[model samples]
Target: MRSHLLNDLTAEHYRRSVTEGVERVAARLATTERPFTGVTVDALAPRVERIDLDRPLHDTTAALDELEEIYLRDAVYFHHPRYLAHLNCPVVIPAVLGEAVLSAVNSSLDTWDQSAGGTLIERRLIDWTTARIGLGPAADGVFTSGGTQSNLQALLLAREESKPGRAAWEEGASLASLRILASEVSHFSVKKSAKLLGLGQDAVIPVPVDQDKRMRTVALAHELERCRQDGLTPMAVVATAGTTDFGSIDPLPEIAELCARYGVWLHVDAAYGCGLLASVRHRDRLAGIERADSVTVDYHKSFFQPVSSSAVLVRDAATLRHATYHAEYLNPRRMVEERIPNQVDKSLQTTRRFDALKLWLTLRTMGADGIGELFDEVCDLAREGWRLLAADPRFDVVVEPALSTLVFRYIPAAVTGPDRIDRANLYARKALFASGDAVVAGTKVGGRHFLKFTLLNPETTAADIAAVLDLIAGHAEQYLGESLDRAS
Candidate 1:
């Protein structure tokens, strides 16, 4: 790792590796011929020499063969289009290459010396993304591991902003009664974040939702007033740009106004839905998103980057400087004199990776509009897929796609009993995913289980959707016949 020896692994290695990996992935994506999961460790040692593993990380050195086999053979790769158990998809080539190059260097990114030019690159990317979200240029942010960390950091910031005088981290939040507000449909991570912040789970208020499952501002105002009467302080309003369950978006403009009126911090958790910022059409869906005190966006989710590329941008850049730690060796006077924006200043991480490089490289190659177009196209494809499913008699479209996710259920006419139909749907969904045959999992809506198709892959088409539907219907028919014959 010496400065002189640094040139040994040099730029040429990264360039060649990037070219090979990207071309391999790009070519493989269309065919769906890649193995679904990694093999066992015991079986993979003979080929262990093929994969990359650094020497500094050696907890698994003894089990390298086993580890490599299991990781390569069993890991559920998000890149595969059929692998839709969660909100993930195939990462584009440029971003993947960006990740590869950064890993080769293994820069810390805590300070200028650690990150070199990465500090500037991350800051600029943050500025670009923040501007799109309607925040001013004064905004600043940092890349994080994923949505959970970003949400936690945002909540921590909200606590600090609301209680500037109180030492919440050390003394653990004062006599002030803190409460967190989020829609009923918001991600569970919101509550988890609040609890982890020492705000307590009881402090999280689950506001009522409209028919579409968006948070009701009227209910929120009532809850705030009720808390006021109870001597509770309204800490922050956690608005969801896209609810995880049905992609329901809490009314952003109205919530923003309510937060402003109450002088509460507005934190938008758009981890799943922030890609709408790229969309000229759906941008209005996230209206007033700009006014948010803080926003959480994951390049991993909407931007089609690999896992662990998340950013939390704030309206005021100085709010980020609040997290700054003045370490002498790290943030020396000379470094400060140079006016470097330490990536650590705005991040919860001490040794952060260069996640921005991917988004930055992706933007440079495809243009921002290209990403937006992908968003719009994926959303529209979800709608078309819904229509195709709804037209068929046996399959039921439970919810029209709110974003790119569609919830559907198979209710064969033979299963006339409501309870029976519910049981059948749940079983079918579980079985399909467990076998990894056209993965569609069950989600509860209105106390009933429905199979979900979260189509983030732009390559996913009507044909793919139709194929999944046929498999589901076939399973439903087979199961239903077995059940009826058993009864007879």
Candidate 2:
């Protein structure tokens, strides 16, 4: 057990162990043929459950051999070209190197004492991002676990800032009257954050989106006026830069102006679209994001970084005081006067991992332009996919993609019934997943089932998309033919 610890004394042992693990992963990556193994849960669960955890394999190679069956053999490979289901991206090499270094050092980014240079590195990265967003000199932020935590912290700040100065109301009344306006297609985290903040169930009002799935600015203005007439406090307006299913961006300039006129806090949830910040060609897409009071960005989604890399930036640094607490044992009031920078002072989490290193190293090794080019490639690929879907007679595309996702459903020429079409599309997606030929995602649009392709992998070619479509058609036609035969 003592030999297992990573320190100066066991440097050789640590290096050898890590090298072996990396070799195993490299081999798996080279040999994996499909995105998934198509292994059923029922068959795989028993093997994992029967493993004797109490029996420790002393040798690293032996332990790895056991791991091959229960974990690696069944793991979903996101790097595969056919993995067009989710927002997961294949990570860059420099970021993976950063992950290796940060994990071994084990720096907790709570205070200066825990993480010395790590603190400065994270702060510098935050400053670089805020500058990219044009958040001004006073802008500040902290790294969070993901977009959800970032949104929660931003809303918490909004809740405190919306308090009435002329009159002191009961705590329950204040919480009840607060409202958050977001597009109906916005991420579910807005509602979850409201619940966590002890707000009423109806605190989040669903603003309708246009056919493009973007929040209608006219409807948003109407909602703001309604809130005023009804004597409710409009705490914040969450403008989504890229919706999950449709990749639709809300009208940012209009929404920001509305927030200014209404004096409401504007929060732009740009988690999926933040990669555009690095994209020279597409940076103009996020035009009015600079006017937002706070913004949430997830580098993991588009920056080709690993998971758990995201930040919440604010235009005004002082607003972060809402999430702060003075603890003598950790971060005290004396440290503030001494100008000692403690990251925990503005974070919702303590003992935070040094996740910013991944992005830092990624930027240093592959400059912002390098990251941007990769993102642009995927966006261009998505446009090509949309064109293919639109021209095809067998599919019905909902809307042209604004970012990198396309939502469409297959329609059989003979299938006149809507319900039957829905069932066929559903069957096709699951069948594709089970066959391990390709992986796709499904969602409902206007009460009709539809399939989605989130093209985050630049390696996924147009031919792969065509092949997957053919596979889906084959599976769907098989099911529909069997159904008709049974009915006759």
Candidate 3:
């Protein structure tokens, strides 16, 4: 038993594994590696040989080799320059190393006893983030799997805060008295969270945006008055720090004021735009985000971390205690009597991963200012890209640059109809994605489809935008121009 526990495979094996893996991947990272990732995935899907059903785990080296081959060969690398599909992109080195250490410890952070040191680390990060947002000095938060979970947690907290001692989870909720206000351009996750929280889809009140996609405050005030007159409870008012479609920042000051008057919880879904808090140049876009009762920020999207690193932060710490369930074995009667804190109190998950380490490591190594500099660089680049797109007569940018997102599409010189602009944008977007040479997002603006570029990559340059625009122009000329005739 002693030999097995302290086996010859102790330090040497661990060192060798990580060393070899890093060495293997380093050359690939260094040379700006390129591979036909999709084709490789298809080829290897049916080609890799697996052990027979009777075989047990064996030859760990063989397993590692197979996995590494698959990773280098088939991985959809978000780091690749031409790999712009979604908000996902390159991850920083410090956080990558943090993931390794956290995995080795394999700590479960539900209770203080389960993760004494980890609790402190997470607490520190939460406190730092909360302070930056100008939340309550006593505000607290927990790492979530991603933005979806963060938004759900925020809404759930708002529910608990609105009606004291009424557990939304245990007693559930009725939609007849519930209404959540948000922009039409808000993340789909808000409506999904409302439905998941038992509020139902119809409970959401989507206020229209002005020419920019920010929520129209005048429209929101009218809706709130209607709800009040109808004797419905206003659950929460959600503001977008950076909307998903066009990256338009909502009128946060106006929204926060409305919420204060109506006594509704103000929640900010800043999953995409939260990093701007670090940017001196662009921080004005999110000026009143700190006034929110809760904020959802995805380190994965904004801070260049791997997926599953995000948080939902509240202005007060005790509201978390309201969401907790006490178990004798975990918290224990003695500990509770002594007033000890547990993470499971605030989080929706049990047996949660030590995801906080990644963000913590990043903050320490890069410094807040370093990350801020990177953020400012990207925002500046996005503006430059937008300017270039707008200058081209063939493409019309839908809105002015707000954050790091750009919405524009191919506009033909001959198109003269009122709806022709939108019609052209829609076709150009569809044609570009159908070929899949590059993937840019698409959505309807003012009841018309508009193409979007979610520029989260700091290394993405004006040339990349030019290339994509060229694709749009070529596709539009081939498909739209001939089909619509000169009248368009």
| Candidate scoring better on TM-score of 1 and 2 | 2
* lDDT of candidate 3 over 342-426, digit per residue (tens): 7887788989888899989999999877777777877787889878987898877888867778877666677455476666666
Candidate with best lDDT: 2
Where is model 2 more than 4 Å wrong at Cα? Answer: 164-173
Candidate lDDT (C-alpha), each: 0.77, 0.93, 0.78
Clashing pairs in 1: 37-73, 38-72, 38-73, 38-74, 39-73, 41-66
What ranges in model 3 sit over 4 Å off? Answer: 1-9, 32-57, 164-175, 413-437, 446-449, 479-488
Tens digit of lDDT per residue, candidate 1, span 176-287?
4888898888888888887787765587999989877789999999998988898787788999977676777788899999998888989999998988978867778788
**Index of the highest-TM-score prediction:** 2
Model 1 poorest ten-residue lDDT run: 56-65
Which stretches in model 1 have alpha-carbon errors above 4 Å?
1-31, 34-77, 164-176, 332-338
Alpha-carbon TM-score of each model against the true structure = 0.86, 0.98, 0.88
Q: Give residue 351's lDDT in candidate 2 (0 to 100).
A: 96
Candidate 3 Cα lDDT to native: 0.78
Candidate 2 lowest-lDDT run of ten? 164-173
Ranking by lDDT: 2, 3, 1
